[model samples]
Target: MRRRRAAGGSGAGRGLRRWAAAAALVALLAGCAPREGVEEIHYRLKWLYNVSTVGDLYALEKGHFARAGLRVNVKPGGPERDALKELELGHAQFGVASADQVLRAAAKGAPLVVLAQIFQVNPLQWIYRPDKSPFREPADLRGRTVGVTFGGNDETILRALLARHGIAESELRLFSVRYDYTPFYEGRVHFWPLYINAQAPIIGERLEKAGEPIAFLDPHRWGVRFVANSVITTREMLRQHPRTVSRFLAALLEAWREALDPANEEAAVQVLLAADRETPEAIVRRQLPVTRRLMVPEPPAAFGRIDEAAWRETEEILRLQGLIERPVDVRSLFAGNLP
Candidate 1:
């Protein structure tokens, strides 16, 4: 048999063929670009894209929104920062946040509605120093200082967990800790709430790099569950932009699909590391897999499907704990063009 020739040939023909291939691929994709229902949207995430907001960041970067003619602006979140205010103040039209904010906003007359549950299972966790002031569990938190911020449903979660475990708020002291995990390392608090996707890995990798080992404790295993961050929009925006919502969700789901790919793990880590450049790659790698696992641990395979049961369960938890009154519309929770 004759030996196979190299595909692009040599010299000038090789250069010409490579250019032609690149041009053709661009033309093919541009030719397939969406022609209908384009919308300009700003997406302010409740937190940066590390763990909490990676789903949105990945969706935005992968052209999920582009095929649907939607442009999204994803802004990161922080302490004393309100994403809903960003939308209400007309800085952004869409964003991700916890339902607690939605309830608080609705109670104050913002007419915001949750659209999608990004993390179906709560990713909230507790981080402690086993070598220092090591915490065995929530019970160990009694009479000890813990660092936390007053955002989302954090207090409600802790209280609910306390009641179940027969722990008392009076037995523990709350210290304000910045969202970062430094306080735990410095012996400022006995425990701190963290998102396993973002903080856990960052802390783990940083400490490991510094020769400081980190210990993680799942609060949910101890009966602490908080509503995960969710996609939300003002009712006014939704009513005037139903098509936009559908398009946005479509693109977001596509991003989740890419994240679901096992081979894309490293690529996904790079995207996440883009969120916090100060964070090490090892941390990002560790966090991304945990976040991905939450999307759909098992799979009949709906990548970004909103779970009404999960939403209501969270609502019930909030209500029984008096975090919300009556009920918020679960149907209005996540709007889509799906049947």
Candidate 2:
């Protein structure tokens, strides 16, 4: 599914043009608007319907937002509307975005707090031509055309990989190849950043079935670290509606758990197909396993728990990449704060 750009969040790290095609606002069908007697909450999406970007659907599907007494309106984000501004102006009661985006929003005093780290791993796959050409390793990408979306996790990973190899941005022909799969397939560039939630595996599987194949070189496997996406909210919401936040998180975790189950998988795909109407069912289905992998259990934690060790590594990558000037104390962006 395509992520329709909402608000100002689709900045430097964004790749895809956020596109919401067929999904109607479900709340609208149920007569949900800012009604006089009914309580309402607006959710500003980081983008429309990317699989990893499904906090709204997940939360709502499991009754988390409804349990919080919020008649949630899922607003598709765009390049012009700022998610932070929407939250600030009370246009949105909550937002579904990344920990990096929350950090930027909080730095601007958006009153946001990260309630949970949804994806334990940032699924960035540094993709190269399957022909096994010059872009085989981190050091090999010095002057290649490397593409990643702005505001997405791939930015952090790309910068970190460059830094690890001691390569300057000046040394490479870096281009913003928004999150479309055509660039690599047509041989327009040598390498591009990918997420398992987005492009790499879906196309890989499709091509393999068609008697052609491509492969992904995971940057984390080469000493790069970044997590894909997470659940973030405002600080006041955390403090004032503490139980509400907790309930929402619990419900969202439940949805995440169900999304991982093999039996319940088809229903989850149905929700996705309905939302990102432009994307094919095959592509959306292909992205599910990688998305499920994000919900896998960590050693000292249960399923759907965020791993601190992974986040610390991500922070280091962001700092080295100059995305975060210096690492703010990491204590602020983890579990245990919702209520």
Candidate 3:
């Protein structure tokens, strides 16, 4: 009986040791595995996929968000989609919006916060044949036919420009602009509003091919700094998921810096082409350098620096134009200390 008991005890002890070893091995494997708290976030863009969103698309394609343990769903915005509204309804955790949009929303009591200013210089500009327009000064705009999208930000900018230069609306013929560029092509309109990076390359290339010399009248050169697209989130999101916001921004801005780097031009172009198959590769190549110039014109200027002055100017423009009912303290809308 003692022998039998000893044998059973020894078998039981070996079985327990094996179980312990197996448990330890499982734990060891788990410890070495990738961390498991991956967050799923929805990010909405102000516009469709193009050179404008190259950095955004690059971040997703290159696994920047994945490396940061985030699963981001990047949704493109159009005329029907409003990023500010998406943020308000919890449809998106992060979104891109223009300064004017942000200000208008804040004026109407939206809890929005600006994460980063994407474009250091606004892309909206007037394209014209310098030979025909001879737009040497704002005064040159007087007695000329200019195209303006009546209710769009272009009108706001044009109004502000004329206001700044003391050029009244009656001084210039404000031609209503639409999707068709026939007026500009036929020289009926002296200056046409087109995004310098998006539409300029296509239109300018066509004009250049036709032996027409083109020049862009930059409002920034005349000191009309209406802020463009910017990364935005709700005040609640910033407060609740500060870490996630920081990580997302860090990943995004890192991707932007890399995407804008001339060294990575081919790779960035590939990314943009993959998302925007409609745009010809040649045009994207042309568009990218212009985008890089607008976003990071000076090498020393930070890519996502929030231009407070620009924001204030944007708000003041909105206020003076009666786009917003009252003043919105622009400073309250920015998350200046971004990671």
Per-model lDDT: 0.65, 0.61, 0.84
Candidate 2 global Cα RMSD: 8.2
lDDT of 1 by residue, 188-229 (tens): 777777777766776766678888757766766775555677
For candidate 1, the per-residue lDDT at 90 reads: 53
> Which lDDT tens digits does candidate 3 get at residues 1-339?
101112334554554454344334323432443553225677999998999999999999999999887889988889988777666555677899989888876666666778888999999999999998898889999999999998798999999999999998898999999999999999999999999999999999999999999999899999999999999886656665667778899999999999999999999999998899899999999999999988984657678988899989999998887777568888888786433
Error of 2 at 30 (Å): 22
Models 1 onward score TM values of 0.74, 0.75, 0.87
TM-score of 2: 0.75
Put the candidates in TM-score order, highest first: 3, 2, 1
User: Residue by residue across 1-339, what tens digits does model 2's lDDT show?
Assistant: 122322444442231111111011222222343432125656677666668755457667657667656666767776666665565544554566656665544333334566666667667676665654455666777667777776556666677777778888788776677656677667677676766677676667766776754666677678765655566655545554555556656766776777677787788888777778887898888888877776576566765566666666766665555555334545565546433
Model 3 spans with C-alpha error above 4 angstroms: 1-38, 297-299, 337-339
Pick the TM-score winner. 3
lDDT of 1: 0.65
Q: Which scores greater on TM-score, model 2 or model 3?
A: 3
- After superposing candidate 1 on the true structure, give the runs of residues whose Cα lies further than 4 Å from its correct spot: 1-38, 49-51, 78-81, 130-140, 150-152, 179-183, 186-188, 206-214, 316-339
| Clash tally, candidates in order | 5, 28, 0
